[model samples]
Target: MTRHLIPLLVFVVIVGFLWAGLSLNPREVPSPLIGKPAPEFALPQLRDGGNIVRAADLRGQVWLLNVFASWCTPCLEEHPYLVDLTRRNLVPVYGLNYKDQRSAALEWLGRHGDPYAGIVVDAEGRTGIEYGVYGVPETFVIDKLGVIRFKHIGPLTPHILNEEILPLVRKLQT
Candidate 1:
């Protein structure tokens, strides 16, 4: 009887684990880099390959680093919202063009709208990996001192921008 109960106990434990996982939100996956300094990088600018944008250069400002790709469908969905956010000028938004061609990135930005104050090309995706990017359309909120405060996975929606991102930006700016 004890031996038979072992299998039933194992099944119960598995179910408990699954239930815990299901209760958690996928978009809110906690990033280890939160409260830590953002990864340092120096990548070529999308508009001018001759110019490089360094992570260190952006100190003393609260900003958003949006990771996007031309081929990512969610990125297209997120673009207009980012454009509108830039119009507000609450915080500077920078783009990391992850693992995409320069020509395609430029064309996509042209077709939609250029929202970024500056865009850096991460054609090899090395910088994205450094930032712990699971996929395209991830965004990071960095404080004035260069510490990462928040990380949002997936596309930005009006609700997320209004309820979460904007509030954090406002607090960080002050």
Candidate 2:
């Protein structure tokens, strides 16, 4: 009876810990960057001209900070939507190109439509680490005061844009 009871207790503890881990890791992360200042970053662009973009430049305007990499397959799927977003002028989109070759990143952008207003080359993922990025294709919506208003994890789909992002932008603008 004692042996059986011990195993049951151990199993329960394991299950409890798993549940805690999942619950603690917010699906979107950083609570969608709400009511917090946008993260600061400065990295050189892979594109020519040697210009760099810093997060500080986004102040006094709502903006989107999208993190992606040329190597990530999903990033490819989401690129055109970002281009569409840029075309509509719905909101400003800035990009973080994570840990990839300069030539490859440049080629990818050139082929894809170059939606981002500015691109940061995070070749070591150090900027991603600063923003708490665990994986590719995470997006953060920043408010005019520099606070992060929302963080979107995973690919950017039209449903997410219509249901979650666009409304938030409207709210922030007002």
Candidate 3:
């Protein structure tokens, strides 16, 4: 009985430490942006001649903002969905081309087919940090009121569409 209790105590201590490590970081805090205003951003266009895109530009419409990098392999995997989304006319899809080469980003879009209605060039990552982007392939769903309604940290999938996304969009409509 004594030996069993010692192992249980050790397990409890380890679990407590693990919880503290994850719970203390603000970065680990899920976005309070949901049901709140999205942080404003003004990023340059990658394709056009240095035009800027702002959070204000997406008001009065539902939009999907995808944070990506030309170098991120997962971003490549998600490109086809972007194309399909644009094709479906489900929502306006925008891309944040994170800290990367201009030529390489363009080449990626060229090779994969540009699906984003607007591509924001965030070469310095300041805008990405403001949006609380921990990594590439994070997506935010902005409602018509220009509020961030949802955030997905990884690749958006068909299952997510069926489960979370479609439901959120339907809710925003009401």
User: Where does model 3 exceed 4 Å of error?
Assistant: 1-29
Report the CA-based lDDT of candidate 2 relative to the real structure.
0.84
**TM-score of every model versus the real structure:** 0.87, 0.80, 0.80
Best by TM-score: 1
Best by lDDT: 1
lDDT of 1 by residue, 1-174 (tens): 989999999999999999999999876668899999999999999999999999999999999999999999999888899999999887899999999999999999999999999999999889988999986899999999999999999999999999999999999998
Worst 10 residues of 1 by lDDT: 22-31
Instruction: Quantify how close model 3 is to the true structure by its C-alpha RMSD in Å.
Output: 3.9
The global C-alpha lDDT for each of the candidates, from Candidate 1 onward, is 0.94, 0.84, 0.83
Error of 1 at 18 (Å): 5.8
- How many clashes in each candidate? 0, 3, 0
Candidate 2 lDDT at 82 equals 91
**Segments of candidate 2 deviating more than 4 angstroms:** 1-33
Q: Per-residue error at 50 for model 1, in Å?
A: 0.6
What TM-score would you give candidate 1 relative to the actual structure? 0.87
Which prediction has more favorable lDDT, 1 or 2? 1
Cα lDDT over the full model 1: 0.94
